[model samples]
Target: MRNLLLSPFTLPPPSGQTRNCGVTEVLCEACDHLGWKKPTKIQIEAIPVALEGRDVIGLAETGSGKTGAFALPILQSLLASAQRLHSLILTPTRELAFQIAEQFEALGSSIGVKTAVIVGGIDTMSQALVLAKKPHVVIATPGRLIDHLENTKGFNLRALKFLVMDEADRILNMDFESEVDKILKVIPRERRTFLFSATMTKKVQKLQRAALQDPVKCAVSTKYATVDKLQQYYIFIPSKYKDCYLVSILNELAGNSFMVFCGTCNNAQRVALMLRNLGITAIPLHGQMSQNKRLGALNKFKSKSRSVLLATDVASRGLDIPHVDCVINFDIPTHSKDYIHRVGRTARAGRSGKSITFVTQYDVELFQRIEALIGKKLPAFPTQEEEVMMLVERVSEAQRFARIEMKESTEKRKRPKAGEEAADDGEQSSGVRKKVKGGSFRGRSKRGR
Candidate 1:
């Protein structure tokens, strides 16, 4: 259990250490292209072990560069033995799977590496085609991968060289144990394996025994803690005034991007619409949305076209957005660990950030649990009650418009056109539509203005 809290300035040289770990020349060049000047703590610890063709269990927090810890070694090995579908990386969420695939592609771009992202809510035939061609690496979610493994013909990982379970704890928590068991039976036993997780739960420990052989443990942080650079605080208010408090905070901290986390998709959508009506550039990303829309929202936020992103826990883990200056826990997570993941979205890669959690009367116990888990007593985020009350009128009007927009969106979904409903087969339903329900256009209407 090494202390990973050392400042980057005082950290040992990563380039010299990575070279000593047998990292290939092409991989180093790729790191340079991606502007990776030095490896993070997780990478410094796990990469060498993985390069030796040994099973590794990486225990580190989110935004710790775990992808490169595994992807680099896998790509280095792939360079030695050119093969399609050489490796498989499993993740809990579709967004994480796509993000990992993007990293693989960026790292292996010079070597002409081909990677395919197989996740649910997308066309099966298109993924099947990609599988038939047999990309160099296959990054997927467990359920969708099992769907392909069982249903799609001529799609098996017979010669897979590496197996990676990224965010193993979340995968098991999402109830993908059966799918993982099925995958294990199909893939070869005599292969390298890597299990990376933020927290090592009992299920993860059990999974380690079932999945790995003589694994080396590389733990950077043995306890639950947030980054030192993160400034965490809470706002205490009545439950009815939560929205007003959020508006006050956003207005107070204007010009900085925010990731506002809600507890449900409906709430996330409502809040995004509410913010949009008040001239805030906010977007929503939830599990219920189509894959293309989810990616579109993420891209918009990443490209700075949107300043605030309202989302559920789906965006909490493994989807890195480096420009997030603040994380507002609009709805306090019931699980304390989730609070860590949500706030981890900001203060990434040595950059300082802020996290403000809203604590209502109903959320007292949850907030206490989060404090206990993180081993700190958070101070209150300063707010002027008068200033917050001043915005109540505008916020109430926006709430009314948001409710109308939500009702209309629900009606549209329920009353799809006759042909559209009939033609909604499995394949056609997965495609991205030009028009999205409850889109930003509704926020710019006359009433919203």
Candidate 2:
């Protein structure tokens, strides 16, 4: 039976069906212009309640259009009064903050709703300047917003009308509890609050109790679930020849866009470098990169200039990248919940996609935990041993090139250059596994039964 419970929603085909959520005519026209013909499931449930002036706790997975759920209502409220510095949206990461700001601008463009993003890696003085202008909406990371609240002259959220904590679980997971508390202390206690998260962990529950006032629970997915359209599979192989297998799969699946998740920032950079050397368009996005570079990488991948994006968990949550045909878990996540978020990058918005996880001998235990969490036994991904072995020579060559480039990049860390991977905080060096290559590529592999 289909899940009757609220779940990460699927977008319906663009039909003559209208998306009238009692939003103003201008907002309706804006939604139409943005091609949001019908709101996703989370939006359908959350928007109406929010329009009724109720606080909401939105439990929706990635790609469920939770942004629209909160955004449309906030804009509608702004329409009624047009209060300056009307809303404050706090996210765990800078990328998500910018994406929220982008949606706000799009949906509220006709009404001229100005938004400012406050996050680290960009100059604080610049962000302070933006705040001084008193934009109608401010989307920020907790840490950075805290910095401004404590340090910036004459900037505060005392009169903020709407407060949204997007990815509340992640924000608390990232140890921003104190920062969040500090923010809550400063904002008006009587304002409407929205807490949106994929999983309502205990920490999130505590936060909701503190932040919202008898909030309507607009839950889409409280379970650890993947989309029904996602085709899940795994490959069992020895750890040594992972690069060979990766190259083999990419060649076989040429023309499809991919997100290859690595365990560390350094590994993501190395994998992207290796893929580029072998004539694949790949880009790396991780925490070590500066804010500008991170956004640049995302834009390149989104614009389809890069066919594969090598990323750590930083790109996993709340980044709505389009046309991602597959997700390759190059390194299996130690935590099972992350596996859900990682693969959620693909098969979004009712589109069918595939996820192939590389289950090395060392990763079997971790991979098993993920299968158990998602409540399914994944079939093995099909692979030809001979085909993978044939890629050994070229893959080894690219590996050498990548290692040399990594060493050179490390030495040149003092000067940030165009196309240079920024120096990671010791985590990058740890991710590139050392292995003997060349004359022998010894590894066990299994094809799908």
Candidate 3:
């Protein structure tokens, strides 16, 4: 068995290298169906190594085609010998779990791959029923998977052949160390393991030691690197005038699609409502939302029905939406590393894009840290103070309505009906927006502010 420890390699995969990476004819047809014309650098390096039946530690950032790298090898192996409860893929978030399952199903459709997503924000009994069937692949979050392992009857991973930990750095960052450790103990020690992450944190290093055995390292881009086509800028403004600046920028870049990142769930929701009040087509996706609602919001953004997506950190890493043309950091991230992931939502697939980070007076130190980490000072996004100030009155009204809606939504949750529990978290947000101001406003992003 030859060891492959690839260093940082440039894009545009080597000629005929990706095609010869050991995928069977069936999986090759599936890749062509998905329009995967050329494999990414990570895929070029990691897939062949993974196909060799060795443990793998892949180091790559989001949008680097890491999913295909891991998915194809596992699917190919599954086709060689069909088995139930064969592979277990763990992700840090529910969105990523579903995404991995999608890719697996799409790529393995010819081979009839059945996957189950085990995560929070859905019915446990339903998941238990799915697990009772013993799916071909299990994609899950660490905590929820442990819950089923302990509580759910007739469910276990003893026969699992593959164990994958995607976003291992974030899984540990989310305080899932004990759960991951518990899961590592329960699964078979004889199975193959795959660990992928953007950063090699200390916790990740420890996890690699415990969970993997003599894994090959596939490092693509480890530094704090942003895409060269991404035009990054920052705006220094007063804390109280953030909404005004945001409205001004949206007005300036009216037609371009955007992903606006906020600091918290409530802020994401509030910003969504405020933008809607100002006649912008915006949707919010946060951890506080129900699974269906979160998926609904994501679908809305993906289909281009909504022009702006307001999201928290949960939407930052690993979930790919290819149409976003700009990113706005409405609230600067406390962790400088998050800035990289946030801006990554755009400038994907070699398309030019832009990102604007809002730097309030109180965020100077934090902004400086981001600049230092990225190794460059970003230009200030040009803005007209008079135009921003001119929108203050209207923006203030929108803010007031957002605050009221947030309070009402909170109170509604405190007194949710038995059947309307899911509706408590922004279900009525769309209809509720139309009711504001006698339904005179049009929630469309193409319109100028």
RMSD of each: 7.5, 8.6, 6.2
Model 1 agreement with the true structure over 1-449: per-residue lDDT tens digits = 11112211122224655453557665787898988888889898999888777999999998888999999988877766677789999999999999999999888876778899999999999999999988889999999999999999999999999999999999999999999999999999999999999999999999999989999999999998899899999988999989889988887898899999999998998888777767677888898787888888899999999898999999999888889999999999999999999999999878899999999999999999999999999999999999889777778877876777776666656887775531111112222211222322224333322
lDDT scores in order? 0.85, 0.84, 0.84
Q: Which is superior by TM-score, 2 or 3?
A: 3
Candidate closer to the true structure by lDDT (higher is better), 1 or 2: 1
Query: In model 2, how large is the Cα lDDT of residue 194?
Result: 95
Top model by lDDT, which number?
1
State the lDDT of candidate 2 residue by residue for 1-449, as single tens digits: 11112121232322332357666666778888987877799988888888889999999878788899899889877766667789999999989999999999888776678899999999999999999999989999999999999999999989999999999999999999999999999999989999999888999999988888989998888688999999999999989899989988887888899999999998998887777666677789999888888888889889998788999999889988879999999999999999999999999888899999999889988988998999999999999998888888778877886787688677768675798565442223323323323322224222121
lDDT of 3 by residue, 182-287 (tens): 9988889999999988788999999988889999999998787787899999999999999889988998888889999999998988988888778788889998
Worst 10 residues of 1 by lDDT: 1-10
* All candidates: TM-score: 0.90, 0.89, 0.91
Clashing pairs in 2: 6-220, 7-220
Question: For candidate 2, what's the RMSD?
Answer: 8.6
Going through the candidates in order, what is the number of backbone clashes in each? 0, 2, 0
What is candidate 1's CA lDDT for residue 157? 98
Candidate 3 contains a number of clashing pairs equal to 0
